[model samples]
Target: MDYDGILNRKPFSTAKDEKKLMYGEWLTELTDYHRKHCHSYGQLLKHLMIPEHSHMGEEEIPMLPVGLFKDMDLISIPGNKVFKTMTSSGTKGQTVSRIYLDRDTANYQQRALANIGGDFWGEERLPLLVLDSPDVLKNRNLFSARGAGILGFSIFSSRICYGLDQDMNLDTERIQQFLDRYTGKRILIFGFTYIIWKYFYQALAKSVQKLDLSEGILIHGGGFKKLEDQSVSAHEFKERIREVSSIKEIHNYYGMAEQTGSIYMECPKGHLHASLYSDIITRRGKDFSVCSHGEKGIIQVLSPLALSYPGHSILTEDEGIILGEDDCPCGRLGKYFKVLGRIHQAEIRGCSDTYDG
Candidate 1:
């Protein structure tokens, strides 16, 4: 199949049946590819007793636990071909998952992100306001999920401005300058949920000053766990942001470094919708059985973009449920769902909790 052709289609245009067939074929091929190149992944397939030449459905595809990346070098590409290595967010002394990418895979990730993001925010590039300090992206070759996300979404920006200083302090002057320059134009704001809540929103709430960002659209995710612990619900998060900035459009996405480009984005209806580049399944923890609609279980993310690593299908530790498919009120033609939270006792990981500033 022409992968580029598939990517060129509108992100949510494909129906579930067609996507299953196409993704099944491509993902099956990827499994064979990884099994041939990565000895560790090959051993895993053998150990699982999956036949080499047998074709499998999307649900039948074998999945590696997301944690395995933290403990093993799971690269399918040659060492010399590694374009960059991305690590999951981790605090001091905590192990982080490392994802290896070659040039081809990296390019695909960027293209996929473009296609998906365009569907949400439109194809026009807007000025981007990053909510984190610029220091996070200093290490170009090796960086955490926060840096990777900033770089990935930077593609949609006409120009970029960091909202925070090197010390992780919210640079109100810089942000005010950016808003003044882009006045009356629609702008894009990107950040982790916790950072925006703790640094951006709270800082503005305490100060007597308020900035008008009515034309700004904020996209945040990756730290709902911390917010949940603080008793901040999604409604409260958005309400607080509006109280300070009056920015009406707010979206929360769900994704991780393991499947960087295949993010599930939240629609206006407040459900995370899976795109053509990716799919989500909820599975029962005890026996790994597929869950019915509205049934909560572990999240199994499937993506064909992880060619440089055997990360195409991963059983994540997060819990969620499928709301419906091909019938979202948001008008997208794919599965839309909600993430309840991480599995109980699951280690704290992801960009939102890794902030030390």
Candidate 2:
């Protein structure tokens, strides 16, 4: 598939009315394309008995459990053409998903990020403040989810500073220096949710100093289980951060290494909305059928961006509800939903056992 034309367009530019038909055609083509090129994926589809030329709507498109990536090297591209392999941050002793990408796919991922990042941070690059230690990026080749996230968004800024010390403490002196140097300029801050809450916000909250970052934009994501375990809700997370840092513009996104560039960003109204690069469908736990708005179920993510691998359609282990469509109070023209955290006992499997026929 030629991604040049698709990547050139701004992210989330498609209207909701047009998406059904547009994505319907695109996803159908991609499914057949992957089936023909990926031998293992073809076998899996046969096992599921999805008939050839099935005319089901986008929601019925066959999806592999996201855990399949950890079990097998699922790729559609030739081995020689593969340019990069992205691994998920599985827990200790757990196997991780290895996502393969050719030159085109990798470039497309960057372009998608650029478009979406521009939408959130504006076109101009800002002084970037990373909440992790610098050592995370030193390896250059392998990446945990945290490391890849830092590197992926680094393209938007020339000046980068790590906000954490080697011991993972809040380096107040370093952050103060960054603020002083970029005074009156818009800043971009990136970090995982729990890390920001524990290391950055808590540390700063305990300090006597007040830092005003009201003009800055903070983009954070990753699993929120850690925070929930500590009794920290998203609302409280935002409130505490604002109380400490004075940073008002914050967006928490939902994304995975499996579908690198397709990020569902939380709008100002606090709903995560999908973009043109991807779409989300909630499935009932009982029958794997699509759920209605305001209904909670497993989240099935679909994206055309995973051309190098069979990650186009994936049944993730997260639960969520489709709150609304085309009518987000934020005025974004797509489906907006809420994540209710990961399914219990879902992470223990190197590969998820659940399957959608």
Best by TM-score: 1
- Model 2: per-residue Cα lDDT over 262-284, one tens digit each: 98888889999888888999998
lDDT of 1 by residue, 99-144 (tens): 9999888988889989989999999999999999898888899968
Model 1 TM-score, all chains together = 0.98
User: Tell me, what's the RMSD of every candidate?
Assistant: 1.0, 4.3
lDDT score for candidate 2 against the true structure: 0.83
The residue ranges of model 1 lying beyond 4 angstroms of the native Cα positions read: none
Q: Candidate 2: where is the Cα deviation over 4 Å?
A: 53-56, 348-357
The ten-residue window of minimal lDDT in model 2 covers 348-357
Clashes of each: 0, 0
TM-score of each: 0.98, 0.93
